[model samples]
Target: MSPHPAPDPLAARLRDVRVDFGTRTAVRDVDLDVPAASVTVVAGPNGAGKSTLLEVVAGTRPPTSGTRWAMAAVAFVPQRAAVPDRLPITVRDVVSVGAWGRRGPWRRLDPAARAAVDESMERMEVTDLARKPFFALSGGQRQRTLLAQGLACGADLLLLDEPTTGLDSDSGERIRAVVRAEAQRGAAVVCVSHDPEVLRIADSVVRLVDGRVVDGHLGAGATEPQPA
Candidate 1:
C-alpha cells in the first residue's frame, strides 16, 4: 500500500474521529479538514453533530477516539451566547472573556490586553454598550456582545455556530458583515448552520447527514449571498 497522506497544516484535521455518548454514538469515523483562507459551513439536521463538531474543535468537548488537530489561536462563538461570567456583567467585561486563553491564572490585564479588548468591542460595535449590562441588551445586541468576546480572543481562526440564530434580519446582516470582514483580515472562519443562506457567504459548504459528511467541495454559489 502507498504511504498515508500528510496532514494539511492549512487546515484543521480530524482523522478517524469518533465520539460516543452513553449508549449511542454522536459521531463516528468522521474525517474532516477545515482549511485556512476560507469560510467553511457545516450543515446538518438536528442532533446530526454539526454543533458537536464545532464543540470538539472549540476544545469544549473532546472526541472519544481520534486525533483532533485544531489550528493554533482558535476562537469560538457558541450558538446560545454564553455569558461565561454571570449575567449583569457589562459588555466590556463580557468581551474580556475572550482573553481568558491568553492570560495565565495569576495574570492581570496589561496595557496590551486592555488595547485588544478595546479594539474588539469597537469592531463588534459594542464600545458604546461597554457600560451596559450584558443581560439587559436586546437579542441582537447580546449577539454582538458575544461576538465581541470572541473577537477579543484575537485568534486567527474562528468557529461560529449559528451566529445569526436569534437575530432579526438587520442584526443577522450586521453579524454576517463582521464575520466576512474577519476573514478579510486573514482569519479562517468556520460556521455551522442548517440555514443555507448563512452558508451563502462561505467559501465552501460541507453537508453533514447523520454526522457523516456528504460533500466537502468549494462553493460555486453566489458571492455575498444574504440569508432569508
Candidate 2:
C-alpha cells in the first residue's frame, strides 16, 4: 500500500494561547498555525486583540498561558505609528538594521547581507530613497522602507501589523505585491490588516472578536483552529 502523505510542516503554532494585561485579557484561547508559502491575515475590529496575537506569534510578547512555537528566524514589523518619526537615520540605515539579527548592531554587514538589503529596498520600490532620512519620507514611503527592512532579515517567518493602514494607492499596491512575493518565495507571512483588499487576497483569514477567535479558514499546510 502507498504511504500516507506527510503532514505539512508549520512555521509557527499557538495552542490555546492567551495574554492578559493586568485586569483585562488581551487574547483568549487562540489556536493558530502558520504555514510556509502562504499569507495569513488576521482580521478584526479595533481592540480585538489582533496586534496582541501577532506579538505572541512574533515571540515578542509572551502569552499568559498556553504554548507558542515559531521558527528560529522571525522578522516582525510594527505599525508606522509605533515607530518614532524623528530617528536620525537614513532609509538604508533602517533596512540594514534587519541584518542585525545575523550580525550585532556594532558590526558591519557582510557582503551577502548588504546585497540582501539592496534587493529588499528594490523590491519595495524604495531604492531611490535609500540615502534619504527615514523621518523625512511620507507615510507611504516610511511604510515601504519598514517592509524592506523586514525583507532584508531573511527570516523564515514574517509578521507585520497594519502594513497598509494609510497609504497612497501606488505605495499600497507595492506593499501588497511584495507581501505576495514573500509568501511565494517560501516564507510564512502573518499580517494584521483591516484593508478589504488585503483580506480578500489572504490565503487564510482569522477573525477575532473580544479577544476570542470567532472564525478562521485554514490555508495550505495549516490545521483547523481549535475550539475555545
Candidate 3:
C-alpha cells in the first residue's frame, strides 16, 4: 500500500482564544485554523468582535487568555480609520514601509524590494498616486494604497479588516481579485468583511456573535467564483 500524503500545514491557529477589556469581553471561546493557500472570511454584525479576533490572529494584540500561533511573517492591513489623517507621508512611502520588515528601519530597499513596491502599487492601481500624500487621497484611494502596502510585505499570512468596506464597484472588485490571487500564491488570508461579494469568494466563513463563533462552514462560493 502507498503511504498517505502528509496533511497541509496550517498558517495560523487559535485555541480557546479570548480577549477582555476591563468589564467587557471582546472575543472568547474561539478556536480557528487558517490553512495555507486559502481565504477565510470572518463575518458578523457590528461589535461582534470580528476586528478584535483578527488582531489576535495577527499577533498584534495578545489575548487575555488562550493561545494563538501564526507564521513568522504577517501583513496586517487595518481599516483606513485606524490611520491618522494629515500625515506627511507619501503613498510611495507608505507602500515602501511594508518592505521594512525584511530590510529593517533606516535601510534602503534593495533592487528586488523596490521592484516589489512598484509592482504592488501597480497591482493595486495606485501607481499614479505614488507621489501623492497619503492623507490627500479619498477613502477608496487610501484603502488601495494600504492594500498595496500589505502586498509589498511578501508575508506568508495576510490579515485585513474591512478591506472593501466602502468603495465603488470597480475598486471593490479589484481588491477582491487581488485577495484571491494572494491565496493562489500560497498565502493564508483572513479578512473581516460583511460584503456579500467578499463572502461569495471566500473558501470558508466564520460567523461571530457576541464575541463567540456562531457558525463556521464552507462559503456559498467555495466551489466557484461569483459575479462581482
Which residue runs of candidate 1 sit more than 4 Å off their true CA positions? 1-9, 82-88, 102-106, 220-228
Alpha-carbon local distance difference test for all models: 0.77, 0.86, 0.89
lDDT of 3: 0.89
Q: Model 3: what TM-score?
A: 0.92
Q: For residue 108, what is the lDDT in candidate 1?
A: 84
Candidate 3: segments with Cα more than 4 A from true spot: 1-8, 81-86, 220-228
TM-score of each: 0.85, 0.90, 0.92
Off by more than 4 A, model 2? 1-8, 81-86, 218-228
lDDT of 1 by residue, 27-121 (tens): 77787766666677888788888888888777678888887776668888877755554466788888887887778443687777878889888
lDDT of 1 at 85: 45
Give the per-residue lDDT of model 2 (tens digit) for 1-228.
Answer: 112322355788888988999999989999887888889999999999999999999989989998888887899998863446677899999999988887878698999889999999999999999889888988888888888999998998999999998888888888888888888899989999999888766889999999999998854444553332
What RMSD, rounded to one decimal, does every model reach?
Answer: 5.3, 5.4, 5.7
